[model samples]
Target: MAKELLINGEVITVNANDEIVEAVAIENGKITAVGTTKEILQLQDEETRVTDLAERTLMPGIIESHIHTTMYGANVLAVSCKDPEIRTLAALLQKLKQHASTIPAGQWVRAWGFNETSIEEGRFPTREELDLVTDQHPVMVIRACGHLSAVNSEGLAIGGITRNTQNPEGGEIGRRADGEPDGRLIETAHMELYQLAAHTRDEMREAHRVASAHFAEKGITSIHDATGYGLQNIEALREDAMSGVIAQRVYAMVGALNKPEEVVRHYMQLDICTGEGDEHFKYGPVKMFLDGSSSGPTVWTTAPYTSDSGNYGIHYLAQEELDALFIPAHEKGWQVTAHAQGDAAIDQLLNTIEKALQLHPREDARHRIEHAGLVREDQLQRMKALGVIPTPNPTFFSEYGDGYVTNYGDRAQRMYPLASYYRNGIPATITADCPVADFNPMRGIHSAMTRKAPSGQVIGEDEQIRLLQAIRGYTLHAANASFSEKETGSIEVGKFADLVILDRSILSAEVDEILGIKTDRTIIGGETVYLRSKEPVNV
Candidate 1:
């Protein structure tokens, strides 16, 4: 492969000092040099391909620390029920019926991105309502959080869920006054029914292709897939990466579901540990959910939700059960990243992790708490001391902030304290739990910097961070969360040439205009994978 040079641009290195250079040289898929245009141009040979940025802004390619690639891809094909698309219960049914018309009868139809709070009804669609859309086809529509879902009568029948069927431990099945299934399935119940509607290998492959292309277009050169759906999902992702269908690097967190022992067996059987695989695909951590989602009012919180006076939310695992899973996984050399949203759940996670550390004593394990949504100051101190990284979804502030206010009231002020994390020297990485929120780093950045909700309300002004800090959370800090900081996080010599060219400087853009900035080009491994159609400015 010939060397490449990107010159005459604002190169925001995002390095230790956050250097701004004019040009960068790449060779053999790695950055070879970064300096002034004249200095970098001197290294170019006759075989070199030079891209004059025309004074465009260049930065390290964005990294999404938390996302479900396969699910995101599948959602691309699912019926759209998100706000602004299906704002009312009537609109939702109409959209579902319209989508069901495109498929044959008796076939399953999956839809996603519906938030009850954003709808006119302010509640999940019931089975009878979904039946109005499709009685012949089994229909399942996922909540925006991906933790809750509603299924039609056909879907219930397919899952063998009856009026007498007991809800799985750590999950709930909604019921009507007549004691019949109401179509609302929470946590485990949601996953159980979803499995019945699983996509085929070919469909999954195509989903991956669509997802990878979408990431490239958005300037995301890397992602940490929060849920690697067991060995099959990992193998599929590897195949996608090897076949060049997935252009970005992927770090997969093993999704063992409720069976942590299964994860241990699989790891031992395959002789695969954390950090296994090449740069393009690698094993990250063993992911487990400690509680449900805040959006569903099921997150295990210390206090009862304002919306539900008596309910303190669901706690998925007992202390002993959590210890049983964590200690064994930690001793087996697997890094753990638990999805703990509420303070109570976070407490359980931190306690289990602390115990695991004491029993195993592995320094720099980099155990992560995904979406520490309601972390306290003391928890932050403990997390910092234990070297635990908190990867929070800042995008939630914009997408679900209004709901947060309704759910937690004044407590919402403490949600996702981005500024507090930095002030206390906690290495926080911001993310968008895509499919929960759109996988747009700019929106996450904007939310972090402004703490502004879609309703034009600021939920927590004290938690707002600077633009630079927000950008770092998406780039360098995100890489650090996955232990890939030394590889591709920043623009530096000897790092992989993962870079993005933006139409404007995110640093200097007007606050309201930040999210409007466009990605001019996305380059990975010294190759241009995505380029805008607009003509580049000539130098």
Candidate 2:
């Protein structure tokens, strides 16, 4: 068989020995050998292709342990409310008016990331206020929390929601002083409008394509796409992978939260999942959400929020209700990654997982807790004991830093404790949680290492992790969380040849310099798929 040799580069093989090799040999899209140039050349036949990358440092392609790729992708093309200049209802209204002109008439105009805390008015935009921007079409703007949606009267009417619409079991409709629906949907209630406007499979595949290219640019070769959005989203990704359009590997989690029967059906069809999808795709885990995001005011907090004394946050399911979903998923041999942010929610999740573990006893299950943002110390120990990986979005430090400090007060110091996880021997991985935060790994690593928020204050200095720890969180630890460490997380011999060559050394660079570390070359399956040099190298 013909062989390929990539020689003369610093290969940081994060294998057992942490081998640093000068060259590697590849055959049939997998590494055949990793050693000195001479050793790799010896194994090559006359038909072998040898390519020297000169001074580049070759390491494992990074893995984003947690993200919502489809949502992120759609957001790439959606109406964005992330503008920094808009700080008041007036400004937001003007921006929406301008945005409406850009879109075709009558199509619903949707926006995301609108936060009351950031706005001068300090409240969700009223449906009446939004109607002024566009009466000809329905307009819906989501709170930055993803747990709430502010809709114009037109939008409310289109969704069949009325003043008498009772709150759904897992969701709420904000009501006026007179008991009329306020056009603000909370928690699961927002799903009614969202589901109606959800993208088709073709749109999702396109979103994945756009998202993959963006990830590749940031040196992210793999991501634990938090949930599949829907079964069609999963199917769309698979179809894209088969057609060779997916440029980054996806560790997909089935996004089945409503239909328990569908969850079981998808679990039973696990045989159809290709855990290994070339270099661009893969599948693992089945996602469930016990609660909503902290920013959303629905995260099942232990205490009432300072602003909302009447509310202790919302729970999508009770303890027993959650266990019914968790136990069966774990028993079916699927890794479970839940969206649990509040301490109360985390405690409930740990209790249920403990029971499931007692029943099944899979010590190395590597079940993950997504957005374990505010875990208690006791919860930390239990997570460590159960090998629950906490896939956190460290980038939250930069985006929602102020809100966290304002919400938790001094206790904000422990919001996303990377150091605590290290001390407890729990594997912690960081990601973008995109559509919520940007999907740049550099930004996340910098946040992990420095604990500095965009507001120029260090929110949790004591909880800051080391640079090496941050790197491993994105690479090795992330792979372990997704159960893909053996093949692709590290640059190891006899493994899939997934390599990321960076423009700068992230390990020895200054904290600020980390953000400038760009991707120079991306190799998947021993083939150079992405290169940005002015001149092409001869192979």
Task: Give the per-residue lDDT digits (tens) of candidate 2, residues 1-539.
Answer: 34678787777777766677788787886888888987887876678787775756677878887777777777666667788778888988888888788878877777888878778988988888998999777888887657688999888887889877888877888888988777789877886677676677767878878887887787777777765346767667767766767777767776643442365456556664325455456667667777877776567788877666777777777888777777877776767667888888889888888888999987588888889888778889999888888887778888788777777666678888999998888878888787778777789888888777668889888899986678778888888887777877776666777778777455567889988888887777766667867675546
Could you estimate the TM-score for every candidate?
0.96, 0.89
- Give candidate 2 misplaced runs (Cα > 4 Å): 1-10, 17-27, 35-56, 84-106, 256-283, 306-311, 537-539
Candidate 1: how large is its RMSD?
Answer: 1.8
Model 1 error, position 524 (Å): 1.2
RMSD of each: 1.8, 3.1
Clash count for candidate 1 is 0
Kindly list the per-residue Cα lDDT of model 1 for residues 1-539, writing each as its tens digit: 46888899888898888888899988998999999999998997778888888777899999989888888899888787764768888888888898899988987788889888778898888899999997779999899888889999999999999999999988889999999999999888887677667777888899899999898898999989876355667678888987889999998888744443465457645667788889889888877788888777678889889988998888777989778777777887888878899999999999999999998899789999999998777888889888899998878888888888999988888788889989987779888988789787788888898888789999889999997788788899989888888988789999999999998766678888988988888988887789886665333
How many pairs of residues collide in each model? 0, 1
